[model samples]
Target: MRCLYCAHAMGLATCPLGTVVPILNRPENADILDLLNIPKDYEVAINMALGYPTESPEPPIRYSDKIKIVL
Candidate 1:
């Protein structure tokens, strides 16, 4: 379905060397839909906040302590 594609796109945006974010806000999607004047048939699938990140992103935290590296 189209929703799945939207989710996949969002996931890809957050993947390594990518830029995209989808965060939940205090207001509900209905509120946004009303403001954006999106047709009732449509819905706000993903709400994103765009801006220059204040600080450099840190690498994902890993569990190197328990897992053994087999190189």
Candidate 2:
């Protein structure tokens, strides 16, 4: 999960591609794992896919006033 989060953050910082998390039980999961030569002893927890965006989206507005800071 931590690795997935770091990869997501890095992707967001470095590229325009969007990230997708595929279901673990999908039929292609095994094939993908095999193709990647991942060890059989390890289980797939999360699968992420990165791809180019087809359209531009408006940036979401942030409400900083709603956030509270505590020390």
Residue 10 alpha-carbon offset, candidate 1, angstroms: 15
Task: Report, for every candidate in turn, its global Cα lDDT versus the true structure.
Answer: 0.47, 0.54
For candidate 1, the clash count comes to 0
Query: Tens digits of per-residue lDDT for model 2 on 1-71?
Result: 46555755665322422233345435567776678787767666555555444555765556758965553
Q: How much is the lDDT of residue 67 in candidate 1? A: 73
Q: Which candidate comes out best when scored by lDDT? A: 2
> Which residue pairs come into collision in candidate 2?
none
Single out the weakest 10-residue window by summed lDDT for candidate 2: 12-21
* Cα-based lDDT at residue 36, candidate 2: 76
- For model 1, how does the per-residue alpha-carbon lDDT over 11-62 read when each residue is reduced to its tens digit? 5222221132122222444565667677767644454433334455655657
